[model samples]
Target: MAMIELPDDKPVRHPEYVYMDYARHLSGRLRRTITGPMWHGPSLREALDGINAADAVERPIRSMQTIWEIVLHVTARAERARLRMDGLALDEPTPEEDWPRIPIPCTAAAWEYSQAQMATAYRSMAVRVCEVMSSGFLKVVEKQSYNIATMSDGVAEHGAYHAGQIVLLRKEIHSRRPNGAHVTDLLW
Candidate 1:
């Protein structure tokens, strides 16, 4: 067969609408999948397993959030969203505003407790996604502050972005571990 070389396309048109829908759908699923106990290892526990406690405490790859901080931050965000969605006034201030006020615990037991709380919060957020889908996609609820999102697209993107940070942090931690074996581990 003769090889044919095609010239580059004159210009690529952006499928902005299609891409937006895809982003909305994909983010929804990513949020749901990561919160569940799936075999593909998307759950919070799965993400936490095999990770050293000390390493997980280190700050995120790009953000100031440590893995522990990220867990707490995500949980708080979910809670705030739920409140706003439910027509409740958020007595709790925004994270950036309240972080200094909301003292982070320093003990091991406290860290574990916070992670568990986050897991519960994430599961609740997933349930809310189902509620919204059942009601209708992008149904504007007066309670939702007119700050609406399609099911979970907005929060999901935020979560997934942080999740990637978590994954990178894990790799860095493994590399720095005493064995330094994961520095060369195939799974890494």
Candidate 2:
């Protein structure tokens, strides 16, 4: 099939690309930080693995959340926003409300299962977003109720904030290890 070329005079819109860019940056940073066995660093898979290993007791500490929780929260937020970006609604009729907490697994097996589910959700959002980018459906600025600039800024800022938190969490976890003798072990 012959490819059709549009006029170069007008700028093309691509909100999905905009969002995809933010996701790429966010995911990259997460993957690179948290490191170990099932808990290796520098990738999304490893980050989640490390997060899952977090102790049940150490998981929910006020502003300091377990890694799994953080991943779930980000995934849930992204999924909800993506749905709205695609012109979808929440299941059933309720007032526009907060994003629901994704139920996580209590035991190891359940934790892995929940992690897989969370991964699926995150991957789904990535796929949908990429699809929107390639299909050009996200090209129009009006297609986004919040527009590309606002959406992009929100994603960037939120991702960075959470990423910073994860880094702090990892440092705290590492510091508490049995052989974790030195203060510099985590700091420097």
Candidate 3:
């Protein structure tokens, strides 16, 4: 079979390479940071594990965001990164888009929907990161401070930051459970 070479796009990960390539490494890091087994602490998914709708909507601290709002914001950021991979000329997300208000009457079904949307968005962003060409990683989008590689790192960092927040909030809510019914078994 004749190997066809594309002039404009060279993949960062070559199948024959014994070691992992740049894009694959970045992709793995991004995935782990968002999804778990991270060395530093709980991943985003782990942080939200077992949280019900009431837990999701609880604001343990005054003026702090609910777990639901953080999930929505993370989803929005992930979606933004995915769209940028397709060369979308998107500007910074508006305040509403960044941290969308939680819907009134947030039911269990609605909370489930938010979680599903967040998972899908993060997965899509990771897929895009894994598919970037070597050159693509170096090419910065106009009006953006980070290149593809750094931007993807930012996604992981952003997720980790929010995950920490969620974990703390979860702890606060758990601590207040009646009759000393704290979540003593929480991994985080």
Candidate 4:
């Protein structure tokens, strides 16, 4: 593929090359939106960084859910979509699965494990997205009406939405601290 330099002096694949390898282009774009630095703000991984178990489990507002529950919920949604994309015959998520019950004590180990699970689910989703893109078959087998490209984009958007919530919850929790510490101090 030929490279063309734009006005900004950034070389991009030629138009012809892009058209010929549209699937690869789509895969790359989806991957970047999911994990790479986006114009809006931090990606999902960045949003969860440095959050301790106490912070994860704390419900700053009685009506709202904890950061841990939100993370698990996001993970469940993404994993379910990924499974469907992979042609797996998994049952639809129940309300309990959608909002998973956080471990009673919310220990550091459990918090870390939840984080790992979220990361793993996202990674799996990304892999399936690439596979769908590479196969040049955007339409998911399970849902004839929906295409993988659209679904992948939706998943990325979903992650960003949850990430924003996590940020807001972190701020709320930090502001409520007894020592009156700033949330900015807790964030990187």
Candidate 5:
């Protein structure tokens, strides 16, 4: 079969080549930053690994956000990005929405649940990215200036940024403990 020719006179390879390359790059980023093995440092999951509900809600550093709030905030951003990529409408995050409030008495189970929810949200967004790429819908949407690829990169970077914060918070929390235990020791 004759290959498709672009305006630049370059013969197009299989559609899979174009789509798969984009999909793999985006998904790999999501995986590495959110849950997969990290080359640079701990993945998001690792950063939050052993945080109990108490530690998650503790503000050891004055005026800084708790791990619980950060987790929810990150999850919300990932979900919103996925919605945008799906061509769905999304409202701007209100101040209250950006940094979520933890329950009055955050329990271990509640923290665990939030972590699970964040994982699910991240996975959902990654899957949507791959779907968009595989379907060859790579052009910028009419409603937005950036394309799905750009959004994917933003999500990965956003997650990584918050992951670093969680790691720092975990260290601070552990340091405040009498036992001086490491964060990894608390992992379930």
Candidate 6:
């Protein structure tokens, strides 16, 4: 059989309708998924609403990550994306750097700091995205398997995906409360 050689350059994936303000679009999405009054339900920040440091650190099941760990993970990923957008040319994060270690003696202050850190990372990434959008995908998209546009979309998707996990975790925690309190009993 004869072997066929593939071309080095793959086809570009510019969308049919160009986004004039794509930066703002993705940035708003990032914000909504992070903290919201989203139409479907609570955002990531909303999911964590009223949860204290103890609850953030509480592992409902031995196998699952604590909310605090999840927050740090999300923040790290966002920061990674921002760095890449900023032209750092980073590869994937190492396994040890994947999920950050939650600090010992986790206090209310630490929890708040984690949340704030998450917000700052997202905001910074979002601002960098504006520059990417303004610059367009011509030269940029070629370098990466996934371009800025797709990566931005992934960020939004990732946040919402984790937000759902946080929601389920909350229900599990609430269900196990001493009084048998149910998250199902109330709107979270």
lDDT of 4: 0.73
- Residue-level lDDT for 16 in candidate 6: 27
All candidates' TM-scores? 0.62, 0.55, 0.84, 0.76, 0.84, 0.82
* Ten residues in sequence with the least summed lDDT for candidate 4: 25-34
Mark the 10 consecutive residues where model 6 has the least summed lDDT: 11-20
The alpha-carbon lDDT assigned to residue 122 of candidate 4 equals 73
RMSD of each: 10.3, 7.1, 5.4, 5.8, 3.5, 8.7
Write one digit per residue (lDDT tens) for candidate 3, span 74-124. 989988888887888789999999999887798999998998888888777
- Candidate 1 is scored at a TM of 0.62
- Candidate 4's residue-wise lDDT over 31-118, tens digit each? 5544657667666667776679999988887887888998898888878878778776556668998899998778999998888888
What tens-digit string does per-residue lDDT give for candidate 5 at 32-132? Answer: 77776776767889898878888887888887888999999988888888888877756677988777778666887788888988888888887888788
Considering only N, C-alpha and C atoms within 3 Å, which residue pairs clash in candidate 2?
13-139, 31-42, 31-43, 32-42, 35-40, 35-41, 36-39, 36-40
Tens digit of lDDT per residue, candidate 1, span 18-124? 44455445445645545643443345555665655565677535656677767777677766666555656555565574342223546677667776776666666
Could you tell me which residue pairs clash in candidate 4? none
How well does candidate 2 match the true structure, expressed as C-alpha RMSD?
A: 7.1
Q: Write the per-residue lDDT of candidate 2 for residues 57-159, one digit (tens) a residue.
A: 2643466656656665655655565675475644532322333343554567765765566456545554554445434433433434554334433543454
Clashes of 1: 0
Candidate 1 residue runs with Cα over 4 Å from true position? 1-33, 36-44, 60-63, 89-105, 132-151, 183-188
- Candidate 4: stretches off by over 4 Å: 2-36, 89-91, 141-144, 183-188
- Candidate 3 — worst ten consecutive residues by lDDT sum? 11-20
